[model samples]
Target chain A: MAFQILLNIAIAFIWMLLKNNFTGVEFAIGYIVGLLLLFVLRRFLNFDFYFRRVIAVFKLIVLFIYKLILANIDVIKIVLSPKLNIKPGIIAVPTKLKTEWEVTLLSCLISLTPGTLSMNFSEDGKTIYVHAIHVPDKNEAIKEIHNSFEKAILEVTK
Target chain B: MTEIVVSILILLGGAFSILGSIGIVRFPDVYGRLHAATKSATLGVICIIIGTFLYFLLVQELFIGKLLLTILFVFMTAPVVGFMVSKSAYNVGVKLWDQSIQDDLGKAIKKAEKKARQ
Candidate 1:
């Protein structure tokens, strides 16, 4: 991962020198160009892992932003409503995520959502404790986490 | 042409900021307020940053690096800071809403205390 990042930065700087523009748009374009170059030269450069990781991170960010919009709208609705009909409850979500970085990413994603907050890990770290503001059903909540946040994190990380 | 889009973005950013502000003020307790403060407020800031970036890009014809950096920094840090603040709050027993239906952490804290005592 570290080596790939250095390679990417190196490519970006090379791109900057080639393009003769150091602006953000140029930098972004250069980055994409660098990414494509890496991808095309994947076998030669042995940068397949870096290439995949970059793409995965991009997809995760897109997914997070899309969900973030929904989360904002959902929270705004709940807040603007007459009766604060929130069924706030804590649920234990079993996680396949093991490593500290992945777990931290997962918890931060969970916490960023509108109504949910990650509270604690179980004694074993197998189960994550989450508090949702309107958890009408525990199973549904768990499934949602599994399908979206956990799945996205899994794809981005190892 | 670009003016219309920039105006729309600015308005949307303002609206998000307003909505989040209302939520922070009106939401019941620390936990509920956090719901607004973290998610909505962060989104609000992002929207504003994006709007500012576009404005700088389109109007001034200067692609400033600092605005982009600010957006990137906020994206990386806001959720993290929010998570830490709320986690510490719960740990130190800042009250959840009166209507909160679960106390999983409370039980866990109690169990840990009992284990520590023994």
Candidate 2:
């Protein structure tokens, strides 16, 4: 709990430094105030497992950075193609994960990837429907989501 | 030199956004158009935010935190919005063009119906 608060303060400091705003005194006072508010909220909400969630968020940041670089390359290929060589369609990808947060993260990841967008999820939460922009192979798309994003999400949440 | 790069990125981002808007107008169906709108528009906004960050970084020798915050916010929100729009469009009975192959959702619906009756 204390560790999480410290981590949040460190992150806030870095963010403030990057922004080139706030002097030393200002940063210290602001951080302490923010940390107090956060701690109060956490206690009021009875969020005992916040540390694990924070770690998961950190992992997600790293994963997102890696995906962002790959997505840029994919989008470049998409833009430069002479013919709009796209076989666009929506695919119903089955979700093996159970939690709402895990499912939502998977959908967001699919959408973030250059060639894919999460179209919908079934009411029962059994499947996610995604739209692929340039699906040369349908099976490949489904497999990618199932193995890549969903697999990572399962690891983080469960 | 830094200013030149920033200008170029800004121009490119604007161009991508314009192309995305054009796609929304030109694409045949709701799904197809949403694809264009979501992908290009999201990328466009990202690029613009990145360019702005770079501009500030070059001038001030520090990153702008809000740029990352903007990226995070867009990354979170854009897809959910896109998903909602597409789902609503589909639910409202927007039909795909004749050329579209493999209606997987339709097949799934049929299979579910068959199972439900039995």
Candidate 3:
């Protein structure tokens, strides 16, 4: 716990330094505020095996970056065509992620991507309804979400 | 010359973003607005980021790998986020303001229900 506090302080200090505005008073205040928030949040959320989850989150972030670049190219093609040939539709993506936070993050990721939009989650949270601008194959699209986003989420949460 | 090109890209990106926001405000339906915003916003953001990277390269004579990382992240996530938002809106009964289309989803749901019953 003490190590975690030190790590957070170090990170905050580095960030402040990078911005070239590191005042001692400001650093101390910011460090304390950040530490307190982390401590409180830690008590509230039961993230057992913290290091593993953090690593998984980092991996997901990396994967998301890779996907973002590809999606941009896809969107550009769709936009520049003289006659728009988009096959837009809604799909029910069955989510295996258990936690609300994981589901929310996955949904947010889905929404952030250019061609896909998260329409809704079922009442029981069994499925997420998503609308894709250019879904060539529904099964393939659902599989992509399940394998890419939900799989990463399951790694973090479970 | 490179600086001018970078500035032009940055300006173009800003223009795209502004046009997207306008589309969002002006478009009749949630889906239409989303279509406008997501595509334009992504392009705009990418242009701006590239411009920044070029500027940094000119000034510092070194590339910042992290800017590329930021671009990659934005490119991947924007569409997925857009899809999710539109889906959620549809589920909550947000209707198209203009009335000139068939809901293929509704038809598919009905067909699936019939197949399940058999």
Candidate 4:
């Protein structure tokens, strides 16, 4: 990732030097040119381009924001309702995430998303214990976690 | 105008923050309260920060990058803090609400212990 960024920067500088146009717009054009050049040469490179990961991260952020809004509305409805009709519980949510950072991210997303708070992780890190405010069905809750946050996380990290 | 938009954002943020506080008070258990506190509060903070950012950029003609940075920082850290607090509370044996429907973690722990015994 660092190498990809440094190479892109180097390419941008080389383009500026060649064009003798050192303005921000020129630099941006140079960067795009470099980005395209790198795209063409990606097969020769051992590692993937950094921007793909960046784009995935951006998508994850957008998805997170969407989920955040939905979650807040759900919580607001629950809180404002006449009665608290919730079946709060802690459920074991198994994850396929391997790295600690990915698991931590998954946990954070789970906590920040609707109806769930990540309480603990299994010793193997393959499972997260999530406390959900409304667990109508354990399987359904698990599936929702797997479908939304876990899937988005897998895309970013893997 | 920009003023109206900013005011709406700030008001929405305040409402969410107030709701979060109410949630914390009304929730039955630590975990349930955390569900209220972190998520709503993070969104509340983000709303306020974006309002500030928009106000500066549109009304004052000043673009402060730090406001954006602050939102990102808060969004990332708030849940971690909640997670830590809940985990510590669990470790301290703070009980789950009696009405809670399940405790899968306890089951997992027991299953692990049985394996160790075998």
Q: For every candidate, how close is chain A to the native chain A in TM-score?
A: 0.79, 0.62, 0.68, 0.89
Quote model 2's TM-score. Answer: 0.69
Instruction: List TM-score per model, in order.
Output: 0.83, 0.69, 0.58, 0.91
Candidate 4 residue pairs in clash (backbone atoms < 3 Å): none
Docking class of 1: medium
What is the per-residue lDDT of model 1 for residues A37-120, given as tens digits with 9 covering 90 to 100?
777777876545576776788999898878888898999998789888887877778899988788878888888775787777
Better of 1 and 2 by TM-score: 1
**Candidate 3 Cα outliers beyond 4 Å, as residue runs:** A1-52, B1-33, B42-118
Which digits, one per residue and each the tens of the lDDT, describe model 2 over residues A1-158? 67767766886687577668878775776676666666666756655645556677677778776775566556555555565555677678888888887788788777777567787777698888777666667888788777767766765766
The total number of steric clashes, by the backbone 3 Å criterion, in model 4 comes to: 0
Alpha carbon deviation, residue B70, candidate 1 (Å): 1.5
In candidate 1, which residue pairs get closer than 3 Å at backbone N, Cα or C atoms, i.e. clash? none
At residue B84, what lDDT does model 2 achieve? 89
Q: Give DockQ for candidates 1 onward, in order.
A: 0.61, 0.40, 0.22, 0.83
Clashing pairs in 2: none
Single out the weakest 10-residue window by summed lDDT for candidate 1 chain A.
A45-54
- Candidate 4 ranges beyond 4 A from true positions: A19-23, A43-50, B111-118
As for TM-score, the candidate ahead, 2 or 4, is: 4
